[model samples]
Target chain A: MSDPAGVIAIGWPQLLLATGFMVVTGGITLALQLGVTKALWLGTLRTYLQLLALGLVLGWVFRLRQPLLVLAIIGVMTAVAAQTVVRRAPDAPRGSYVRAWAAMGLPALVITFAVTGLIVRVEPWYLPRYVIPIAGMVIGNSMNGVALALERTFADMDARENEILALTALGASPWEAARESVRTALRAGMIPSINTLSTVGIVFIPGMMAGQVLAGADPLVAAPYQIVVMLMVATADVLGSTLVVLLTFRRRFTPDGVFLEKGWRPHAR
Target chain B: MDVSGPSGSGKTTLLRTLARLMPGATGSLAVDGQRADTLAPQRWRALVALLPQKPAILPGDLRTNLVLPWRLKVERDVAEPGSEALLSALDEVGLGGLPLDRDATRLSVGQQARVALLRVVLTGPRVLLLDEPDAALDPESSSALAQALVRIAATGTAIVRVRHRESDGLAARRLVLTQGGRLTEAGP
Candidate 1:
């Protein structure tokens, strides 16, 4: 009874259902005199425009599977992700952008290669349809982990300056001095992944699995892909955040093992 | 030697700099004729230690807090202190008979101060920089600390103490750190 050719297509009239819901939410906010009505309208408009642009660009990219184009796309995505991490983590130490880039890009690239080449084995390995989405997922999640780790680690150090100073006075290396904060930051970074892992199936269906099922794939087949993707995401998040925290912590201290008193403010450049 | 200054003066900062724990400090620092920055940071800190006004008692039993310096690779030159040595150190600082396994974080300020000093003594630094080390001590504990300082000094270790009160007969020379950041001898 289901058409197995492809997914059910969404047209403009059908898209009105989502638009109507957004209007209703915005209307309610206006009626309640909440200041967020403008924000709601603006956010919805932005999302619609952004997604439309992305759809057009992706359509063009999906047709061109050249490796150079794919690499360029990944490079831009990684640069944007690194910038986002720096912006979100206000307390992150100075000169953290480069470290953020490496933290986000390295593990994401590795995992993307492993998932595409080893696991999914997509033809050409640079097929935009497969690689773009997978790399986006990896980079986006790793970016979040890096942001959480940087913020949490710096906040902890600020709160426990005396404690860290005591360790420094007692001949502890900067790494040793900040060990507690590092552990806490790493745990904080991994929390989202851990939560997603624990709640994936029972609480709610994940987007990828739902998308695959709606596209007429067997639920059983879609489930395995979701499991694999989730595992890869968790691994990328942990590894990326760990490396980010370790590298960033080193930058927080001078070579003489002193905690930088200015406390990792971003450089003017 | 004694370093006395007003509340806002930079006595603590100077001691931390001397211990090579403050990076932005501008000056040359040499420990035992070797440039402080030239030596490995961990090694320099082991040789030149600082005891702050409020020392952090790490989350563990008292014994673990005392032996943490020994656990670090930088302190490999000093063999791990046995329980006998630890008890002797504690007794020398007037904190004898306390259980080694008791949670250190719960100790009173005075007791914690003694434990912190005992830790520095166990490490056997060539120079000890103490910031208000006896601020929380009672007369008996203060006397005990003074005696411990004498013993540590007897081993040819240099001691720099920061105090607000009059010199307690321990310092060889007294320099009052003025509000202007100048160190003027206490006596006119």
Candidate 2:
């Protein structure tokens, strides 16, 4: 399976070998009559097609090496990530999609640029190979952070309605009333990244590191890249969650500082 | 002043409205010749505090709960009461035995109700909105609470209390909320 570059080339036959794992999973689902076999197979097919399309597109972008094209792809990725966040946090207040876009896009793009341009010092700042993948990781992690923070914020708003009202009655502003909920939501959002940072190598080799190793990179050389990725992820998570929380907490109250009742919808814009 | 009505009547809603804690509520409110709309919501609420029927005990010790209002940025200018004043006020409200360091959540509902009342009262609002402040208290504790309200009223703070029990002789005037959601004077 080794190519001339000494890296294992995953051709159709090797992919068929990987498909066997899914077949085993499908068989287990069938044996248990788990109803999800149909969904599982559909998901598997979708994953294969989507990744194949992504690879072709990325290959084209890499060959061209145009900065604008790379940025366009990142913009599309951010839009999709924003939509995913909104879907994941269905109970979040209306207009949360816009906030999620800003929260996720701002930190992910900024940190990715900093990592590539300043830290990794990619020869050309807009190098597609470095920028696209780093931006994807940052945006993906940031999307999760924004979604978790938004969902936890709404849940806390419902659960802590009385506490918030109590604070307001004592002359606390909207921000003051929502302070505790924001803190908890930010913690919920950042905990996954923190856990990954703490247990990256000990518990599991992350996908990026594993991919580098499988590509014939030395394990010791690949370790530093994974460290940067993990730290960048944690930074993106905190910054995105903080922005989301700050923006969304005010929605829990009216302009007059009254806490909105559960299921209260915003005025049609 | 005291407001009384049947359980389904909107006494709580009325107090919340007075405190501007209702978004849909529309009316003009004035405090000491200053229009409410002119003041910031935080400042308006500071001048007119509401003590809800269900007390909200925060996650902290008794002292923290009592001084919660003072800790707010809006209340930065307001001086927090000293421990002696807090202890004496607690004694006045029939919660003297409770220590300052006691876990607030561990207190009984009646005790928490008193703490809620004390929290608003200590802020020294010009107008106090109390919703069934003594509903959970024993008769003795109820009397102490009534006496404390009277003393607070003496300091020129207008008191609007929603009560279900017979009058404790504190209200200068009493009003009843009819089922039609109208407030009418109740015969003394």
Every candidate's fraction of true contacts kept comes to: 0.78, 0.78
lDDT of 2 by residue, A59-162 (tens): 99999999999888888898899888878876677777788788888888899999999889997899999999999999986677778988898788778888
The window of 10 residues in a row where model 2 chain A has the poorest summed lDDT is A260-269
Best by TM-score: 2
Instruction: Count clashing residue pairs per candidate.
Output: 1, 0
Q: How high is the lDDT of residue B56 in model 2?
A: 90
Report iRMS (Å) of candidate 2.
1.0
Write candidate 2's Cα lDDT for B64-178 as tens digits: 9999998898844458998999999899888987889999999988888889999999989999999888889988878888888888989899999999998777788899998
State the RMSD for candidate 2.
Answer: 1.9
Off by over 4 Å in 2: A267-269, B75-78, B184-188
**Highest-scoring model, lDDT:** 2
Candidate 2 clash pair list: none
lDDT for each residue of candidate 1 in A1-269, tens digit (9 for 90 to 100): 33556778888888888799998898899899999998898898999899999999989999876888888888889889889988887777777888888888888889998999999999888889999999988887667777888788888877778888888888998888999999988999999999999999999998889999889889999998899889988998898889888888877778778776553444662
